[model samples]
Target chain A: MTSSDALAGHTFEELSDYLDRDRTPADPSIEGSPECQTALNGMQRLRSVHRDLLLKDAQRESEREDSWVSSILQHISLEARAGRDIPISHSSPTARLSVTEGAVRGILRAAGDSVPNIIVGRCHLDGDVTEPGAPITVRVDATVLEGEIIASLADQLREALYAALRQHTELAVEAIDITIRDLYQPFVPPAKASSDE
Target chain B: MSDAPSPDPVSTDPGTSSTLPDRLDKVVLAVPGVDELYSAAPLVAAVVKTVIATTVEAVTGEQKSNSSVSVDEKKAGLEIAVKIGVNAPYTAIDVSRRVHDAITDQLEQNGNPDVAEIAVSVARID
Candidate 1:
């Protein structure tokens, strides 16, 4: 490609390399004028716009109210409550416990309660608990469980499942399996301290 | 005790009345992240409050309000906050960072800090 056209794709450093090596066209045409310095200016403008967009995005993120988180949790909980039953195939197992991703998220949210930065991942029930007398094992993947929070989450899940089971049927929970999949990093808001003049 | 007569001070200075508010508006508008400069009424009132407070403090040499700034992101795009008595020196950077941080914190806390653009303004006491 021609030098000017090549510049459109190449960064300032690359273009500088071409100029330093005298590979740029020697013609005095406006397209190839040495007096017309344009590459870095365009890059600077582009960089400014990118940074502005980031700042704007950050501002938008900080201004959202609590309702958003609440709504997301509510939606997940609703989905979990309406658990679907996947058909048991062949002779592998007769009991089936199928839960939607939404329900799992909801259960996790319920378990998390007011805990911040808690995220739920893959969830599976180990044992068959679909029948009235069958024992069940609930396996959950979670992040951001520290110290007693894990135990607290487990307790919260037990209560949630117990209530859910009581409402749906009379199946008793044999064991609650909680696997700590991930940990969440707590986000701290920037401090606005007044600088003394 | 010369209590015979007191000349009435000029209460109608057109230049002061006309230019002061416009200057205040310009100063407020000059602060970065201030979008739709005309649409900020509550913020304008807050600025006026700050200006008056600052002026009173300057006259009496007494601290009237704390130097802290409070941000409230309600209806003005994504993030919004008000700085009552911002100190000098790092006024520009402080205001900019405070607005940015307020918006960022609120969005991060609420779980969607990457969707919208936020605007902020500062209100300084006189």
Candidate 2:
């Protein structure tokens, strides 16, 4: 295959798609070409940026929200699976109410976030979420704002999270355990502003 | 075809109601960690409205629809939904919960019942 011909038909985007699917139905000509292999390598490197999962980490070092945060948010799922149905008191025996695991997770996140300077990270409901009244553990990792008292923040987060869960969900939470994952730096004014004339 | 009045451009903010939507709008916008509130309009109109609202708010201390409210004539209630852009430092769910509580409180305080449902969509994180 000529150097240009190797990548002529399939765009880099197409080849990346092909690579993602294990290059199924491989075209012999592209596979055999050194030039094609080089282009594929370049495409792989580009994909690695997203693969790295450049999360927001809520860095407010600027006026606008960071561009990376917007990108990450676009890919996040809002309709996370709601767990099995938990029954509610209905006059009609057939009437039932249920909340999903996703909904429960939403509650947990909300509760944790309610606490000042606390942003919840990964949240897990670590037991049989499907079984009603089953004792399930809630575990979450959170980031705290720098300079905040850790003990006080934890206490506040615990209280808010508990209240939110109680008000919203029927889950018999066995325990809510929060692990402090990271501390974010507070926004600092520019040196130009701070400099005494 | 079911006979239905082309429901007045029933925005969550119809702007017809004097205090309820206006009061709720004030309370929602007042919440901390709330970066933005949503409005409905064509691209050009929304932009124009935003410009005007921001300008007026600066001078009059009265804000326009960051959120809106509408009533369903058939149903015995009103449904309110608004898109909010909030801080990433806080959780969207928490912000929504806060906003929900505030709106509910205002609606009840105003003696308005049939506030059937309120949905706070996190349109962006700032």
Candidate 3:
């Protein structure tokens, strides 16, 4: 560091971690620092948002259709947006076999998310998704739960995606490129063995 | 008209006005090609639906639908606006028409007539 990087030699996470250890007897260093105060405020906002989400989850879970309700509204909205029309083999001019880029994206995202402990950070259908019979590449940056081997997890995700595409879409999936963006651990992972192998 | 406080139009009594958004939220959510709800705030729910739900979806990025549903009670009728995220390959006009029908039919079923107009805004394609 630079002055912009830290508040008197402490990062935001450091300040937050310090408070996390104890919230009752406030730490003088953090309380006295403006940057720490700002970080605390940010954490407070995040906590409130998290609480709100839990409440919403409760409401949604109480009714089985609450999740469906979310999907339907999103479907309607997505069906209306403009993008390249991925063609499917349709005989009639009036009849169209086309999927929206957004729809493809949504499908890919869902598939990625379907894998246990997988969350997609970024997704793209690289290549003209609208072109039927054209080889298309799907790229996704994803985060996986820690302690799981990355290669195995990625392979599983890839298989799931390929299966979903085969079932739900007409696009020719040439490749699915998964980049492991981060390791997600709700808590810290155990340190690796100190073997020299 | 069966003036039973107009089915709690924009007030405390839980009836048509209170549940219209909830009804819309269900039906509209069932429509295909949806991604998220737009502009709905979190923790604000009905017995006073539309306003809170529609507004809050915009606030919290978590558990949001690509479509937003709003019901405004007016002297003329119920003014409804839905902001939606559409699938790029689909036609906005067709999808919006479907959304309009869904909202209208829902309102009518909830004992609400006199729908002033439904304004469908295409917020984005996600």
lDDT of 1 at A11: 35
Per-candidate TM-score, first chain only?
A: 0.39, 0.56, 0.53
What is candidate 3's CA lDDT for residue A53? Answer: 38
Candidate 1 Cα outliers beyond 4 Å, as residue runs: A1-83, A86-119, A145-149, A193-197, B1-126
| Preferred candidate (TM-score higher): 2 or 3 | 2
Clashing pairs in 2: A82-A100, A82-A101, A83-A100, A83-A101, B12-B68, B12-B69, B13-B68, B13-B69
Q: lDDT of each model, Cα atoms only?
A: 0.37, 0.53, 0.54
**What TM-score against the true fold does each predicted structure earn?**
0.27, 0.38, 0.37
List the candidate 2 regions with Cα displacement exceeding 4 Å: A1-79, A83-91, A191-197, B1-126
Q: lDDT for model 3, on a 0 to 1 scale?
A: 0.54
- Per-residue accuracy of model 1 over B22-124 as CA lDDT, tens digit each: 3323444455543222222333454455577689889998645422223223443332223222233223234434444444444443334232333332221
Candidate order, lDDT descending: 3, 2, 1
lDDT of 2 by residue, A18-119 (tens): 778877888644443223343453334324432332223334326555343332222122212223433222232212223334445555554554566666
Residue-by-residue lDDT tens digits, candidate 3, B33-120: 5443453322123113444445676687433232236667787777766555556344444555566667667666666667665665
Q: Could you report the DockQ of all the candidates, in the order they appear?
A: 0.01, 0.02, 0.06
Q: How many collisions between residues are there in candidate 2? A: 8
| CA RMSD per model (angstroms) | 25.7, 17.3, 16.4
- Model 1 residue A196 CA deviation in Å: 8.5
Across residues A64-118, which tens digit of lDDT does each residue of candidate 1 receive?
5532322332232223322333211121121121222222333333433333344
